[model samples]
Target: MNAIEVENLRKEFKSYSSRSGLVGAFRDLFTRNYKIIRAVNDISFTVKQGEMVGYIGENGAGKSTTIKMLTGILTPTSGKVIVNGMNPHKEREAFVRTIGVVFGQRSQLWWDIAVQESFRLLKKVYRVSDKDYNEHMNHVIETLDIGPLLDKPVRKLSLGQRMRCELAAALIHNPPLLFLDEPTIGLDVLVKLKIRQFLKEINEKYNTTILLTTHDISDIEALCERVIMLDEGKIIYDGSLQKLKETWGEGKQIQFTFVSEMSLDTLKELTDGLQVTWKQGEQANVWTAHAPSALLPEVISRVVNRYSIQDLNINEISTEEIIRNIYEEGVVHG
Candidate 1:
């Protein structure tokens, strides 16, 4: 069964076209002009049960808007949104119970309450049984390492501490679906790593369906196998992450440090017919080459056999680079 089913879903908002200057300001006081903005254009997609899908796009690209619709926070202007076999907006109370949402910039925990107190409140709100709550809470606290944070007030905890608690709060009900919006935002590498690891473990252990929306490319790369890329409120690309990489990520930047200084002409002759382009570095012994990924083995083998290399560095196409290419140049190459 599909965890999420959205068909031609769209959201629109109105923005005031306020004019400048004294006369315009006086006119605007009496009358205001509005322009319609389609935050989410007609788009359609589905996520299978227990699947982890990345919903990615730049700011104002309707990522949050779509999430709002799915979570029943906002009503869609048109089209259909069904999450976990029920209409989110229509069946809000029951729908919310089946899903856990974490917004990185927002807090679901009460500001003045202790983290443990907040968890209890959530358990009460969700009506989780004592046995079930105890089991889940123990696992969550241990896995997220939030035992030290349980007694502290939500506002007193550090951002990382609070975020860890946030995950615990969301999972208190043991919901089948999880919606994460930049859960790792503003976190240091260590915190991000912990969050990613926790997410992976829960998804695997419980078969939880996850819809992760993030600008942190590493988060998507680490947790998601498929991505639904949005641009200007449109679904630009939706498919396997590996396929996206292979299709747009063939170029590689390889750097080599030779044992001895090699002249540019000698370097050129050595790499001839290898479909590689040479770029000189500041130091004569160090050189860089841009080549297709397919030719990496041939380039490395040829250079390794012929020359004594001190060091070699290979830089693969980053997820950011791939997405940037799709944005700058449309998905289809002519």
Candidate 2:
């Protein structure tokens, strides 16, 4: 089953302006000057049931706009959105009950209320029965390790603590679809790991369909097998994560620190005719090279034979760098 189906989706906002003067102000009452800003252009995609897909883009790429339309917070100017077999905007009251949303910087909990109180309010709002509520609530508290925070006021919790509680609250009703926007933003390493693990387990155990949007590349790398990248309100790439890496990120970067400095020219002589590009690092003793992964053995062997290496490190081209390049170079696909 398809969890979400969007076709020719487009959203536009009007920007109106007028001259600053008494005459202009009077004229503005009768006449309007405005331009249409297309936040989300004609884009289409489908998310399968139980699939965890990453929706990623740079700022101003319309990620938030699309999400707003999906959750029924904003109406689309054109096209269609069907989530869980219903229109989000048309079937809002019933639609909201089937989905859960979590924003990293925005808290759904009441600030002055105790965490447990807030959860109780949500339980009543969602009409979750006592039997299922207790079963799920206990499971979430144990999984997130937020049992001790139940009595504390929302204002008293740290960012990590609040986020854990947020996840638990979102799951109180056991919604089938989950939307997470930067759920790991501003979180510590240990907290991020725990949240990622929790998400994975939930998806596996209950077949929850998740649509995750985040600027943190590590989160996407860890959680998503497929990614939909939007640029200028259009879908630039939508495919497997591994295929993306293999296609655009074919080389490995090797950083070497030698006991003695080696000029780029001399290093070129050592690895003569090999397709290695060497660049100097900020530190004089360190140098970095980019070469095909298949040629790494030859490149490293040649360098090791000539220099007394202090340290050597091999790293794949990061997803962050790859996405930046795509943005700058305007790489587009159909």
Best by TM-score: 2
User: Least lDDT summed over 10 consecutive residues: which range in candidate 2?
Assistant: 325-334
Encode model 1's per-residue lDDT on 116-208: one tens digit a residue: 999888899999999999888899899999998888899899899999998889999999999999898899999999999999999999999
Evaluate all candidate structures by whole-model CA lDDT and list the values in order: 0.91, 0.93
For candidate 2, write residues 129-150 as lDDT tens digits.
9999998889899999998999
Best by lDDT: 2
Model 2's TM-score against the true structure? 0.86
lDDT of 2: 0.93
